[model samples]
Target: MARKVIESVTCDACSKKGLEVPGTVNLTVMGDRYDLCDEHGARFRDQLAAALAPAVDAALSA
Candidate 1:
């Protein structure tokens, strides 16, 4: 088993301060973890939704 390092300080995506601090969440994707602020986290969520929206629409239409 590989060791999991818990370095929850800065946002891995944007290097924003106060990552994984109080009242924050830790995001993990494809075995990679990320610590993002509220701003970046909302952006990520919107992006993911947008990415899936087209596919979902297509599937529904078909």
Candidate 2:
């Protein structure tokens, strides 16, 4: 068996990151791709949900 060496991966949000890709999420938005750490990814998702909440409520009411 042989081990392969790969480049170091860092959390897009972590300082002096020890984590790497294949571990982080690859999120694509508006034709742009971004690699984000777990915390950032969850934050983004929360923000998106919050931003859309008003619209969602309006649509539901209508």
Task: Give the winner by TM-score.
Answer: 2
Q: After superposition, how far is residue 58 of candidate 1 from its true place, in Å?
A: 2.0
Residue 16 error for model 1, in Å? 6.8
User: Which lDDT tens digits does candidate 2 get at residues 1-62?
Assistant: 99999876555655446544332766677998767777778888799899999999999999
lDDT per model vs. reference: 0.70, 0.72
Indicate the TM-score of model 1.
0.58
lDDT of 1 by residue, 1-54 (tens): 899887546555565442343325478889988776676788888999999999
Which sections of candidate 2 miss by over 4 Å?
1-9, 13-23
Q: State TM-scores per candidate.
A: 0.58, 0.59
Q: What is the lDDT of residue 2 in candidate 1?
A: 90
Q: Least lDDT summed over 10 consecutive residues: which range in candidate 1?
A: 16-25
TM-score of 2: 0.59
lDDT of 1: 0.70
